[model samples]
Target chain A: MMNCQGCRDDLVAYLDEELEQSMQAQVEDHLERCVSCRQEHDSLRQSYEFTETYLSSLEPSPYLWTRISAGLRGEPMPVRAPWSWLAARISNSAVAVRLAAVAILVLGVGSSWLFYHERKLTGQARQEMVQFVADWEGLDVSRVNPFLARHEHPVDELEANPFIDLHHHDIKNPFRHEER
Target chain B: MKRPKTEARAEDERIGELQEWLQRSKQQDLEAFHQLYQRYSKRILNYIYRMTGSVADAEDLTQETFVSAFQNLKKLKDDGKFESWLFTIARNNVYQQFRKKQIPVGSLDAGGEEERSEYERIAAPVRDPQEEALYSELQHVVNEVIEELPEKYREVFVLSAIQHYDYKRISEIVGRSLASVKTDIHRARLRVRDRVKRYLGQSS
Candidate 1:
């Protein structure tokens, strides 16, 4: 008869029905001959049976299942997004590619818009600048108050110097003295 | 003759109905998606709860799994393998999580991939539980014990003990040989047995 330890060793496999035919026979022989091994086998079997029962009886959390079912209805579950799966399957480059295309389109449209606006603005600025210069040139200086309402020129006094007038007055007498 | 014909017609009609549902779901029909959800939610929830130790996380993961499965159902190559495919998707999701945790257990490295697969064979060890009442406690202990075990062993233990997957399926899941899976499971069981015994002795 095999000892308690030998039966104990095989007891797990026996409960699982995983032992080979030869080993199975050996365990059977040991069980029949050894009371201690038999008791151990029974305990081990019960333990395994207990585990199976308990495991099977376990109920999943109710609220979580409710959310899961709801999520199946096209609602996104935040906490369980399976980001790793998403990451492995979807690349940032794909998104970047689409975004780059969009940016190029936007830039194309924006550049065209700016070019049109800039051309218009430049034309307007040139027109305004030319109109300003023409208006300045068209100003009638003869009618302009600053030039027409002539302020006194101190130089006119020099032109009409009293000394010169006196000299002329006296010289006129000297030239006409003989005749007088 | 009429009865047989009617029965055949009925079976065909049922299959046709399910097929239509499958097609509608693939077409992103919300109502169809809901119908599918209603059909399998409970079973899936239970399955997830068993796989994951937390009822809360299981529930959340279950919902997430379904949402993902619904969105990607169109990608399924064979609609007939929906059950296994769905489960596989769920399994993939779960493994992604374990991988995300980035917790490394010991290496099961054999020389080549074959060498590595050999380690997986003795990885999952089924620990013995003494009684039915202690089963739940045992499961809790089992989960804890698995976490404590090396990575290769943990994978084997989880697949065989908690997930109750056959060696062939586990072989496919882990990409190892059937022989390797068997050995890994055997070794895992032994480790679990020793750990649980020690843990129980300490607690008592």
Candidate 2:
């Protein structure tokens, strides 16, 4: 013998068929006796039916596929820039527009400062590298160039063996000579 | 609606064809993947639209969902779970968009007069003028109720009612326990019923 509150608590689950068979029977029993509980059940059922009927799924715009395909290909949509869209969304607010301008101005100035600082640092690094190379130019080349001596030897060997083809060629028919 | 046996059989056949398409898509078959997109794009679009209430946001989020899904399709281990996987991607994208915009939960600004007008314009037509007016009013009320629902309840409610996902599938899509999803859906349904009772009373 379930009370009205207990029955009401289980009504949603019973309607959803989520309740066990025994508990569902208890709800049904309560509904049979209690008009209030039964009305509540009907109201809940009607709400479900109403929403499911009226809140129908909509057909997306025809161009949605085009946009999706373009997106999948990493192409931007054939629409205005995002900032322009944002501007339109907040176009009614003069304050928002002014704030956006301020933010953009701040960003522009900050980036310019950063760029200038980066360039100055890069120029200093280049100057330091030039000075270091100039200082190192007086050092003996032999200590650093073990391959320099071997490089000349390879050139001399190549000159001596100018006609000696380094590439291997297989003669399929050594005895067969073309008629000149 | 209960489908007839023949219809169910046809549905099964379609599911088989879809599985084939899924496999070919995994092989980088563009045509096969396009077939998948054609089949599912509308459902995904509508689901996102209902969730966001703003058509523009829904369109962008739906595109992001499909793009993300395609990019990460190779990471998906099971072909059978593609629908839920795609839904998970959509849910994540919607949440990310919400976070990025910092839109408060249950804010009218999220879907205001513009969304209402768009919804009314696209609602199904009724034969009688008076009936059409009544239906439109009811639609407005219902849409308001949905848009006003808290974010947590909104997702589960939309998934269960509008998307027709089962409790288990909704749980999977939302990454919540079955008990929690069920509780949220129950509460959401009650909330919708209470809010729309006035319009429903008039119409009935």
Across A135-169, the per-residue lDDT of candidate 1 in tens digits comes to: 43353333232212222334456458765553334
Give the per-residue lDDT of model 2 (tens digit) for B173-193.
889998998889889989988
How does each model score on TM-score?
0.45, 0.68
List the candidate 2 regions with Cα displacement exceeding 4 Å: A20-23, A74-76, A79-180, B1-8, B106-111, B119-123, B199-204
- Model 2 clash pairs are none
Candidate 1 local lDDT, B103-134, one digit each (tens)? 33222111112221222224323555555335
The list of candidate 1 runs beyond 4 A from truth reads: A1-14, A17-44, A53-58, A61-66, A69-73, A76-180, B1-57, B77-81, B98-143, B199-204
Q: In model 2 chain B, which range of ten residues has the least summed lDDT?
A: B106-115
Report how far off residue A20 is in candidate 2 (Å): 4.4
